[model samples]
Target chain A: MELTLGPLAYHWPADIRRDFYARIADEAPVGTVYLGEVICSKRAPFHEPDLPATIERLERGGKRVVLSSLAEVMLKREREATAGLMAAEDHEVEVNNAAGLMDRGRRPHRIGPFLNAYNEATIAWMAGQGATHVCLPAELPGHSAAVAARAARALGVGVEVQVFGRAPLAVSARCYHARAHGRHKDNCQFVCEDDPDGMPLLTLDGKPLLRVNGIQTQSESYVELVEALPELAAAGVSHARLLPQAVDMVAVARVFADHLGGMCDATEARARLAGICAGVSFSNGFFHGVAGYRHIARLGTAH
Target chain B: MTGAEDFSAAGELVCPAGTPAALRTAVEAGADTVYCGLRNATNARNFPGLNFTPEELQASVAFAHARGAKVLLAVNTYPPAGQLALWHEAAAIGMRAGVDAFIVADMGVARHIAETWPRARLHLSVQAAASSPEAIRYYCTHFGVRRVVLPRILTIPEIRAIRREIPCEIETFVFGNHGLMVEGRCSLTNWLTGQSTNLDGVCSPAAEVTFERADDGTMRSCLSGFTIDRFAAGETAGYPTICKGRYAAPHRPEGYYAFEEPVSLNLGRLLPELMAAGVHAFKIEGRQRSKSYVRQVVGAFRRAVDSIRSGHDPDLADLVALTEGQKETQGAFQTKKWR
Candidate 1:
């Protein structure tokens, strides 16, 4: 199965963002890349110059790039952006919500992790709307993903999973940055530039809790499916999306790529991933239909 | 929009005010009734720099009353653990200030109001997300909710279908940032940060955000710390929220909005259609907006309703500049093929 690097949910500097994609374009073994500003309309202009360049570089280097739509509600500026993305000539688009489906252009489009695809009917419907691939929401269970995958395969729609990185659990309208700094959303001084990785929160007992990303919230632990890969491949998932995190991401991508390429066994892959990703926990809770933070059968846990 | 007006108007209009200016704006703008909560978490819009101090609310109530407008105190916040007293006190003081009713959402708050003042009128808040007619009827029977503000996810057909089975006046968001997708129970905000619009009555707490000019001439905006959106130098930027930002997917080599883009719901054109669908009252969003906005938009909608009643086409104004980054959308109201 192909490995897709999901959008960088963190706002890295233009150079850092460029270099990140550049590295992926040249060195990383991933097959696909999805990129764009999916949170606030203000950030859309930042990546304009670099996005086309990176897309061209990635395409020249043999990586397929899919443009994405926002995952939450829309405002006018966002609508224009959506229209522009839908109107783009060459690449396919990943629709995060159903809003883009109303005016989706004739492209081999896919569905993003949002749109609340809770059941098989929604998946089947996306296929009818001309979705070629669909990534299930992070909160969906593995069994549900499998069920949706079977349906997708039947309808000729490719199914993907977020096998690594923190789970994107929810999106919101309120800007946490402005709220945190005692500013209204309109006057937010662009304070979110301080943290490249999302702002981290800890429980009262000092446990790593969650990371805030503008209006979107994500999990503290990364999710990995090294052991579950065989099951997922057998269940008809076409690809796996690896979200680039703040640390060891290149190495992390290599580990997954190695596993996918049959260069490493499941046990070695898990071990190498653990060595590179120090101390941060991994969860399949969303796939297992349990609490999102809980890791079932953790690495190094006595069986 | 579908069907004729089925439910007769009952109870009153319960509006919102983020500031005292908005309170006056709502009052003078022809609000039949005005609703607000204390500066604490007694109401849902508990973001900073909003709501009323006890004295201001009391004064605002007097002002509204002298102008023949009724004040409905919204003590609708869910009570935090072991903190029922804060909600209780907000309700008690609202009653003392001669509020016409208590717009309550939580069952605990409803119980508190009932036990404290048996004669008080209580309307159900939209935080309850009671969609089915059976569900709303259950609230009316148990909590004595005089009215219900229906969630915006419903179409006119759905609202008319609901009118056939409910026993309360229906209020729908007419001109405002209608949250079409998010349900009341979502924690996408809380999961990223420690605060939430539901638990804390706040979303995307400002203290956690930062934005910077990336070296590549792209501007990146983030909430908490996650990149919500990135804009090139020429593109317009709205407030940075995660769901509205563009992200990359494989299908398109270019980046796009992977969740949703930030769009405001401006259903100005659909007023005639929604009115025919048994809607008793229309609600405008953005208690967090400016007084000038409050005066213009609310007054505009008020006039729209009057114009509709007089069987004239409503005067249309391009109020886009009043919006965040001046962006607005018809949302899900106009599209029949909406997924």
Candidate 2:
């Protein structure tokens, strides 16, 4: 199984992003890295100037690089950006929205998780449209993922599943991060930068329910599939994705790599991951077909 | 601006009907088109005690057709893996029922409908979340989609801009739930309740919802055991959908609507503006509401459309009581500042 890094969903400073990618290029045990702004387009300009250098560095480090498009493409500028990305000649583009798919018609591309590839028939249709790889949506249960992965594999398409990081629950036309601060999406002054990981939102009863990052809403707990990696691989999934969070992602990659490589057991890997993402909780219930916020312990590996 | 005569001729009033009764009510109340779904996961409003059976859909289609109204079948939800048979069956039923169009979201469903009938009309469901001209054109080019329902995330200017580019017809939501999140892309309810609008065709499924009276006498609405919102005495409590729920954040310890307030989207005043923007159809969203809601809302929009077509200001009914949370907003239609 191959370890892939998903695009960053935060608004970290340009230099911080550069430094973070530099480390991933050098030390991260990931086979492929997705680079681009998948959330708010307002933050794309800050880090876009350094894209060429980062892509080259990751490529030189022996990692395949793919550019991801925005999850929600409403504005003309966003459409233009999606078109530009779709027209790239070098790096493979991952189409997250329909605009990208339309622009990249019949061209080789990867399907991002943002585009719902929920069923076998959808995967077949995407493969017919020249999609070479597909990362299934985060909400799929184990049975459904297995079915989708098998179908994609039968079509000579690579299947990927997110194995780490907060699951993106929703994307909106309005920026809740800005709205929470009493500002509009237009004049928010880039306030989402304050929460690199994402601003936490709790329920009325004081339970951490979700995280708001610009227009995207994410789960409060990081989705850790250390125990489920073998199950996923057995079900024909070739790639496991790890989304970039505010934590030490390189170390997070190592934990997943070690678990996938059979160098450490699931319990030890979970412990190390807990230490890395110290304060945050972990969940795997989405795979178990229950509420995504709950962590379902494996039957034999209950700790 | 387009002439009043041209606006009236081109614009269509699309209304919702959860059941055969609602379908009749909407058509008789002056809906040019009525959209509904089968009682299954093939449509977004897969609530129990709602939607139509095959026989009911056939009767309703005939009834609407007799009144010079078109019937559209909503096979909108994404079919789960190995579950295409269910949606295909629903489509076959709709076809046999002689529905005028099939409103769809999934590519597989769209491809099936396009390939099966070859000449069947397809309206891109809002759940597809196609906001731009390119995306809409993609559907029109690929599946020969006749019309596209724009997501409730675009402003009037954006809609006008899109109208200048796309080849197919444009449909915009004129009233109903202010869906803050992009349709088909949202899984907040699934994360909390394990049933989603995209996959299961339900949001915060009624089976998972519960209501309780707190010690202070305030009503607490919960979804899947999580407290979504609390309403004071005599305040109308809204459905326990995750997005419109009140939440507590560090910035505001006092609970606030973290995603969106529980307000309905009422574009009654924007009829003339949207008509001027080249919108081919105005859609009302409430498949899970009552038959009376269908009559009142559809009748009100019918009069509004007629009044606007005659070059006069519309005298719309006050639908505040019928709206969610007893309040309404023009939503993202008027301005992006609604964010």
Q: Pick the candidate with the highest DockQ.
A: 2
After TM-score superposition, what is the CA distance of residue A12 in candidate 2 from its true location, in Å?
A: 0.5
Tell me the TM-score of model 1.
0.55
What is candidate 1's lDDT per residue for B1-339, written digit by digit as tens? 001222224312335688888989887886766777788877888878998888998898889889877777777655532456788889878877877777776655776677568778777777655555645765676566767877655567777777877787787776665563344435555545545455457656667677667677877676666666677886765676544555442232255544445777777777777778777777777778788877777676767677778888776553343454655776545542231
Residues B1-339 of candidate 2: C-alpha lDDT, one tens digit per residue: 001112125569999998888889998899998999999899999999999999999999889888888888999999888889999999999989998889999998999988888868888999999999989998999998878999998889999999999987889999888888999998888888777779889898889999998888899899988999999988878889898999988888998988888888888878889999999999999988898888989988888888888888887544333453467899988878976
Per-residue lDDT of model 2, residues A1-303, tens digit only = 999999999999998999999999999999999999999888888988999999999999999999999999989789999999999988899999999999999999999998999998889989999999999999999889999999999999999999999999999989998899999999999999999999999888899989999999999999999889888999999999999999999999999888888899999999999999989999888898877887888783422
Give me the displacement of residue B61 in model 2, in angstroms. Answer: 1.0
Q: Score the docking of each candidate (DockQ).
A: 0.04, 0.81
Q: Identify the runs in model 1 with alpha carbons over 4 angstroms from their true place.
A: A1-303, B1-15, B250-253, B317-325
- Per-model TM against the reference: 0.55, 0.97
Cα displacement (angstroms), candidate 1, residue B103, comes to: 2.5
The positional error of residue A186 in candidate 1, measured at the CA in angstroms, is: 36
